[model samples]
Target: MTDSQRTALIDHDVWNGGLFGGADGRWYAADQTRDVIEPATGERLTNIGVARAADVARAAKAAAAAQPAWAALAPRERAAVLRRAAAALERNLEDAARYIARETGGILAKAQLEVAEAATQLHIAAALPLQPQGLLLPSTAGRTSYARRVAHGVVGVISPFNFPLILSMRSVAPALAMGNAVVLKPDPQTPVSGGFLIARAFEEAGLPPGVLQVVPGDADAGAAVVEAPEVRMIAFTGSTAAGRKVGELAGRLLKKVSLELGGKNTLIVLEDADLDVAASNAAFGAFFHQGQICMATGRIVAHRKIAAELTRRLIDKAQTLPVGDPASGTVAIGPLINERQLRGVDAIVRASIEAGAVLEAGGTFERLFYKPTVLSNVQPGMRAFDEEIFGPVAVITPFDSDDEAVELANRTEYGLACAVIGASVARASAIGERLKCGLLHINGQTIADECVNPFGGRGDSGNGGSMGGPADPDEYTQWQWVTVKSTAERTPF
Candidate 1:
């Protein structure tokens, strides 16, 4: 699709002016405005109004005020609304996908997948209301006792730019499903896909006003959401550094916080692994979406017996994948999100090379279009091996023994996702069990998420809280114990 054709898909009147305050279905102008740039062309897509602390407070207050009525509705009623919203998302998938591609520089396929995942999240959320909310408890005195889940008043969702739709919906849908209002603060760079699209979906599905508010802004807006007294919980998806600040503030406020943070994940290729399959998985894990995903494989730990062959195959894949504007629909890789991200990726590659890592392929760019890069002989201390590069770069480190391979993979502090590929599924599963990551894949790639599965990480990647499936109830609601006595009994004083 042409750039103009993509931009024409969304309603210009709603987004052209400024901030979209989902509380009232109105656009509020801001004192400062941020230009949304299409990374592929380095051109201005549109200008979004920057939300401030006061704006966030307004949204939070609205959400708090709307919470009781929303929570009072029958579970079936809520479920019906969520189901309609999921349908709306599917009906408008193409339009939403175009917006995602234009705003985030993702290929059409990736954008469509994101929209599909988002709809799936809503469908999952719809079923949550029908699940049993309370459980019977044993009582010694013949008094009836039970424990039931209740929603927190309001939830604050701070989402990242990459995979904006899916990340935002995973929290927003479940929070709303469990009877909590949400104040979403999407990253400024992707306000439309991350926030506006979601708000529109719910609005179209007949959601009450103030039930969900999308406020796109910077750190100030996020802080306001976290600090607001009415907001009882915060769901954050971003970098580890930023997550620490959010967690500390939420901790001080005594609020519930679910954090899905960064990962310096690894893909392990064993001696008996199929070189072709191992290399394919590594490239897909590291280069998909320009490797902007938090679960992107940052390092490849290969056995010495097969490392050379695996590296050669990886280099070939890296060198051949097409890189250009995703709107063209022909390239396999698109541009980085922005110039700053491009520079960061380049610096990591250069620093890794200087630190004695071999540049087997890639390490070149034009504008924000960074070619997929592969670095060999990388060690524990090297920048590419140690840091979350957040780019299309793969680092390979060879180990002679299974113990050393496990050691190399476990050396990093970030443990979000890991993948093990070997001829023996049993051996691979054993090695995977020895690793410390939260999500493990045997004979597969590292980047994956499902609405039915529990998604989270350990160490710096998360704070013991998870999302999706049974974890959703824990993250979005609190347990309350109730005891009933048919007749009043007097106690000795």
Candidate 2:
């Protein structure tokens, strides 16, 4: 029922799960569905399908059966379609950015940046068409003995709410460029618009059917996606608890799996740090997106000498951050994605205060726009201090020495990313070396950019899943090796 303008696929009508939609003459709906709401405001936006176990199995099987023909296409040919898709995105950046902000409660600038990244990422993935590497082996001196990177077939990708557009693209683009069909499942809250548009645009840009299928649903669909045997690989990003489940299922299926899970990151500010600069960085990192980001600076270890001044400035700045509508250009911060996460933030901070921490500023704002909270006197024992409190609250404590700061920073189970703020390069480098994190930033700190760093983690930080950046998605794929000898040269055999 798909039209020429968009590529659409469906599960068998008998398998109607809990979600359904119609686009370009194709109708899809589940028997049960959940409504989506704007986190900043509790108004219902739309309903999303909550897929049944059967739907996941169907998508997985389809992806597997289509893999071979897809893999056989010239990499450059696949890249061309990606180029077209990128071109399509550039033509509609404004609408796409708006959709992302509205659905995910992302600020306009940040959402636009995401849209820009999506376009650039499409091109980046497109450019990697011929990058499959081959090495000359010592075992065959007379012939070119080497291996080639190839598709791993069907890769199941599950995304989170924070970066719905970008993360989903991060998973889909590379998988597509490498000739692998994808089973993409976005967070139920923001599923319909941004991702649905991407699928539509790519199809218009000449992508084939069954390449990037979107199955919108909740955890049950996620489980279905991971457990299917036809799924060749699983790329997931979310909480650690959920990641454990996904990993186990992938193991049972004997498939390749990559996970990017929870993070409890730290920002180290030494005495030599620029107080004003460090304060500004800390405020933004801890409060932007209402501090729901995984790399949000949840903990801060400031040098005792500058701790008081830096803390004061950070408090002042955080208090002033604009919290309102996502579409408004003036608003610098937005609401939590949902009430559940909002309650989670409150519970963590409340326990920390009860357990002997001081609530500095705006510790618990009543509005949907959770106030930017900064806590001092926090220690390792409290859940607010120990776990990933994905909210706009930050816990700051002073450290007299670099060793104490590094030790305290590295104490968490999650080591996704860290930041070192200091005036000189030596301090930054020293702290970076001692901090146990997958990605460490020196001098300045920010969430992430798809261009500069391909991200993952050590310890429980991440399971070496690179969404974008240096890991080279072109190379992230599975590989194959082959050799050929002339008939005249094969006499002995």
Candidate 3:
């Protein structure tokens, strides 16, 4: 079969069986539907449901209906189910990975890595039930005071198009392990990979009906999931504009939310840094998945002394990058997810050029394939430097001093992640500390290192919550308090 044919969307019960909902592991596929198109070839791969508000209502109602019983299950049992799902994901990782490569337009090796690591994340999150605890207040002796970490009931998960499998688990797996039923609204661009595959995993793993629902769709379908009053909390990952509206709606409804929004993360390459390392990191930052990353390195502050050299090497490295047929084992970069993303990349490139930013390399957009772009002579003030260019456009700005580099890196509203490539670890860390990003790496690029720390961002790049630390997802859903008083009776006041 041709590589193009390898990534074709496989038919599934979610569509063919009139499957609008899944409860007790039985799919009730009776809903309004649509087509799942291949962004790479503009081909209609298969029929997929564009679930209506009523359909969403039925699914959520089913979840809400079943949540309490699921919650009643032993935490160990919950953990066991999650472990089973994780195993099932591992079993089908190849199937899911290929789908991810096709549906999301990410390359083969990277898609395989994403699928494999996403399985690990799910497995890790599945361990949350084992970590649930009650903290005792060190108040008065013999006065029973402790806080229970409990599920927030029905939870809504809204994931974006890029990195669908990984991002989807970034929210839903934790919710499920903590005994909360999940209503997942995976990005329409990644239905087969993230949404459909996830449901299949849970189903094969014998997960209870209504505990996990993967509803594939657009913003409206997501709206249906969010507008449900029974949804106790929402965890969203996507654009800043969309996130704002989601946040506002959640606020009006008084529902708790966790948002992982857009970013214009910068990479700083100091004069003292290794030029080769800087070039490679920058390339990986912007070229991975064609830079559709929310935390991808959008801007670079390279030392003027080495800017020309690094720019040359970056372009040389990017030039050799393989493109086309994401399911092909050898393709390095794939096309944009759809025309919307393709246009967005084009607009950013055009605006950058109009703003007088120099295009170093890869400013070409052909069909859905946007070349890996590198821009030099970029101003820190330009939109290309400040906006989240969710494409492979690397806008490089030069700075004379280390202080200027730090200032340039921290100039954006996004405090997602940033890096300092320097000769001295001490100097790099010092610069990293001064920068205003949630994650700061030394001699590396800003990317999601799944096991290290909190992967979300800050400011316009992140959502409102007291969860600034690198705690597990279950930790955020818990509430803790302490009461101090004597066990002996006190006189009435």
Candidate 4:
């Protein structure tokens, strides 16, 4: 069927797909369902199935049983599956983008970007199986040795609500390409884009039954997926608090875990930097998707000389950007994921202002919609400066020297991503080297990525695991050294 036709069926309630990727190689309706409320309009978007612990167990069991047969397939054949999936996703890009906007409360442009990123990720993963798998090694006389890479069997993925599509595919595509089955537990808030859309793409691409199981669930169901005996590893994207729980549980179970957690990312503007460019990039970095991204620029450290100009420009720019429903093509900023999140962001911003942060512009909200906000003269102890205010809020703090800027950037517990904007590339590079972060950008926003870059975080942000480029397959598989010998060598004791 054409993409439009299928989406129209979904929009019209004519194609109400189930939630569970069953052990019997088919989708099944759950015992219970929950209403998925649209963040933009505060209305029911659809009713998605909710998986319980039993459902999680069934999915994991199916993944374990299907893994061996999938791994046995020729590498080329496996790669083809991912390629087909990518094609299917691209074909349904518009439909999926609309779903993303409705469910996540993201702007239309951001939703479109997410779809594009997912397609690119899938395409990149499709080449994993075709890449060289082992290395030749010199050995003793009449013996040969080599190191081979193999799948980790069944991988469990627990994704977050923000950027659900790309984050899930970051692990799912790579795991499948590396010859492993996956049990995906997408955030319940974004079931349509996170769960059903992905399942449809894979099914349309003709992926083997039981290779991928998506469970739409909450915290309890997520814990069940992590605790499943059949799951060998877990890839999670969420908050640091949640990451700690997942990491601790996976550590106790001796399962490999890769986490893409929270961040209070910093963006530095040097004295010689272009104020206009800096202001524009800063506004985009802090307000895009209502600043829900883990890598969003939460803190802006500027040199004392240009700090005022940059902050003023940012305040004015933030005030002018339209904020409203995602469907309003002109709006750049949209509502938060839910009412609770809106209230949390509101509280944080208010606390920061009370703690001496100068509210420069836009510090109000209507329902779930928070205005694009800028805070100047923000001090270290303020909630806006110290915490991840996952909303359209940016705080500007002045620093006297390059050393102080680097120090302020490193003060936070997070070391996820940081950016430096300066006239001299050499100076920026030097400062970038001194910052403690997993990803660094010079003359750009804190949030930037490509298919070739190894995307991940450091410190509380993650556990030294990455999800792109050559490192992705490494994270999803195990390396083994195999040696063949013609005869046993004699040893003297």
Compute the lDDT for candidate 4: 0.88
Worst 10 residues of 1 by lDDT: 1-10
| List of clashing residue pairs for candidate 4 | none
Return the clash pairs for model 3, or none: 18-29, 18-30, 19-29, 20-29, 24-209
Residue 456 error, candidate 2, Å: 0.5
TM-score of 3: 0.92
Residue-wise lDDT of candidate 1 within 394-456, one digit each (tens)?
899999988898899999888899999999999999999999998999999899887788999
True-vs-predicted CA distance for residue 296, candidate 3, Å: 0.8
lDDT of each structure? Answer: 0.90, 0.76, 0.77, 0.88
Candidate 3: residue 147 lDDT (0-100): 78
For 169-222, candidate 2 gives per-residue lDDT tens digits of: 877888888788888888887775435656656766767666666787778989
Task: Give the distance in Å from residue 127's predicted Cα in candidate 3 to where it truly belongs.
Answer: 1.8
Rate residue 161 of model 2 by lDDT. Answer: 87
- Which is better, 1 or 4, measured by lDDT? 1
Candidate 2 off by > 4 Å: 1-27, 141-144, 474-476, 488-493
Error of 2 at 313 (Å): 0.6
